[model samples]
Target: MTAIVEGRSANRVVAAAAASIAVAMVGMAYAAVPLYRLFCQVTGFGGTTQRALAPASAPLAQRIGVRFDANVAPGLGWTFKPVLTTVSPRIGEQTLVSYTATNNTDRPITGTATFNVTPESAGQYFNKIQCFCFTEQTLQPGQAVDMPVVFFIDPAILKDKQARRISEITLSYTF
Candidate 1:
C-alpha cells in the first residue's frame, strides 16, 4: 500500500511539473514578439529603423534625396498621402515632414501606421526623432488630420560602404 501511494504521488508531481512547463512556454511565446521588436529596433534588423533622442550636431556636405510615400489599407476608408513629395536633406540635418489622413466614410475608424525605408540597407542610418507610426489614430467621418514625422539621416551613413552610394531613400508608410 505504501509503494502504491508513493507511485501515485510521483505521478502527480510529474503532472504538475509538466503543467508548469507548458505555462512557461506559453508565456515565453507571448513575450517573444515585443522582445524581438526591441532587438530589431536596437539593431535595425530587417530594415527596421531606429528612434533618436536628438539630431546630429553637424550634417554632412553630401545631399540625399528623400521621398515620402503613404497609403491607407483597403477597406480602411481613409485617404492618406505625404504632404511633401520629396526633399533633399544633408545627412544629420533634422527635417520635419507631414502626412495627411482623412476619413471619407460616415463612421469613425482607427488605424495604426507601419513604415520602412527603401534600399533596405539604408534603414539602419535612418532615424526618426518623432513619428506617428504605431500610435492608434481615430478619425470621424469627414475628419482630416496632419501627422508629422521628425527625422534625420544619420551622418554615419556616409561611413557605411553599402549605404554611401544610396542617393535616394524612400520612406513608405502603410496604415
Candidate 2:
C-alpha cells in the first residue's frame, strides 16, 4: 500500500514539471518576434538596416552611388516609383530623396513598406533618419503623394574591409 502511494506522488511531480516546461515554451514563442527584431537592429544581420535619429557630423570625401528601387505587390492598386533613380553622395553625408505614390483604385487603400540594402554587406553601413516606410500609408483614390526618405551612409564603412570595397549601394522597397 505504501509503495502504491509513493508511486502516485512521483507521477504527480512529473506531471507538474511537464506542465511547467510547456508553459515556459509558450512564453518563449511569444517573445521570439520582438527579440529577433532587436537582434537584427543591433547586429544588422541578414541585410537588415538600422535607423538613426540624426546623421553623422562629418562626411568622408569618398563618393558612393546609391540607387533607389520600388515595387508594389500585385492587386495593391498603387503605382510606386522612385523620384530619382540614383545619387552620388559622400559617406556620412545626409541626403533626402522622395518616392511618388499614386492610388489608381476607386477606393482608399493602405500599405506598409519594407526596405533592404544590397550588396548585403553594406546594410550595416546604411542608416535612415527619416523614411516613409516607418509607418503605414493610406491613400484615397487618385491621390498622389511624394514621400521622402532621409538617409546617410555611415563613415565607419570606410574602415570595414568588406564594406569599403562597395562602390555602390542599392536601396529597394516593396509594399
Candidate 3:
C-alpha cells in the first residue's frame, strides 16, 4: 500500500511538471510573432527599419486596398496622420514616406513607434535609412510636426520568388 501511494504521488508530480511546460510552450508560440516584431523594430535586421511603406510601385490588375492606422495611448494624447505614403519601388532602391503628428491633449506626448512592413515578408527588403518613425517624438499640446521616413527596397526583393507578385505595402502606427 505504501509503495503504491508513493508511486502515485510521483506520477502526479511528473504530470504537473508536464502540464506546466505545455502551458508555457503554448504561451511562447502565441508570443513568437510579436516578439519577433519587437526584435526587428529594436534591431533593424535585414533592412527592417522603422518607417512607413512608401507608395511608388507599379499598379496591380486591381487596386489592393492598403490602409493607414494610427493609435495614441490614453496618457499620451496625440493625433497622427500619414502625410506621405508608398506602394511601389524598384527592387534595389527605397521608397519615401512621411507622417504628421499633433499633440491634441493638454500635455506633451512623447512616445516611440514600432512599425512592421506587413506581409512582413516584405520586411526582408524594406530599408529605412533615415526615418523619423524610429525616433520618439515629443510634442507640446497643440503642437504639430511633420515626420519624414526615407527608405529603399533591398536588391534581393527582386530575386525573391515568393515576393515577386507583391507590389504594394502599407505601414501603420500605434502609440
Candidate 4:
C-alpha cells in the first residue's frame, strides 16, 4: 500500500511538470513574433530598412541609383505608384521622393504601408529620415494624395565589402 501511494505521488509530480512545461512553451510562442520583429529591425535582417532622425551631415561623392516600387494589396480598392521610377543620389545625400495614392472605393479607406529595401545587405545602410509609411493614411472616396519619403544611403556602405559594389538598391512599399 505504501508503494502504491508513492507511485501515485510520483505520477502526479510528473503530470504537474508536464503541465508547467506546456504552459511555458505556449508563453514563448506568443512572445516569438514580436521578438523576431525587433531582432529584424535592429539587425536589418530580412531586408528591413533602418529609421533615422536626421540626414547625413555631409554627402559623399559616389552616386548610387535607387529604384522605387509601390503596390497595393488586393481588395484594398487603392491605386498606388511612385512619382519617379528611379533617382540617382550621392551616398550620404538626403533625398526626397514621392508616391501617389488614390482611393478607388466610394468610401474612405485607411491604410498603413510596409516597406523594405532590396539588395538585402544594404538595408542596414539605407536610412529613412521621414516616411509616410510611419503612419496610417486615410483617403476619402476618389481622393488622391502624395506621400513623401526622405532618405539617405549611409556612407558606411562604401566600407563594407558586401554592400560597396551595389550600384542600385530597390525600395518597395506595400499597403
Q: Each prediction's TM-score against the native?
A: 0.90, 0.94, 0.60, 0.94
Which residue pairs show backbone clashes in model 1? none
Best by lDDT: 4
Q: What's the best-to-worst order under lDDT?
A: 4, 2, 1, 3
Question: Distance from true position, residue 168, model 2, in Å?
Answer: 1.0
Candidate 3 lDDT score relative to the true structure: 0.66
- Candidate 1 regions with alpha-carbon error over 4 angstroms: none
Q: After superposition, how far is residue 103 of candidate 2 from its true place, in Å?
A: 1.5
Per-model lDDT: 0.91, 0.93, 0.66, 0.94
Off by over 4 Å in 4: none
Q: What is the C-alpha lDDT profile of model 2 across 25-125, one tens digit per residue?
A: 99999999999988877877767788998775788888999999999999999999999999999889999999999999999999999888898888888
Candidate 1 global Cα RMSD = 1.7
Q: Candidate 3 lDDT, tens digit per residue, 98-122?
A: 7788887787768888566666666
Off by over 4 Å in 3: 1-69, 85-87
| Lowest-sum lDDT 10-residue window in model 3 | 58-67
Alpha carbon RMSD to native, model 4: 1.3
Pairs with steric clashes in candidate 4: none
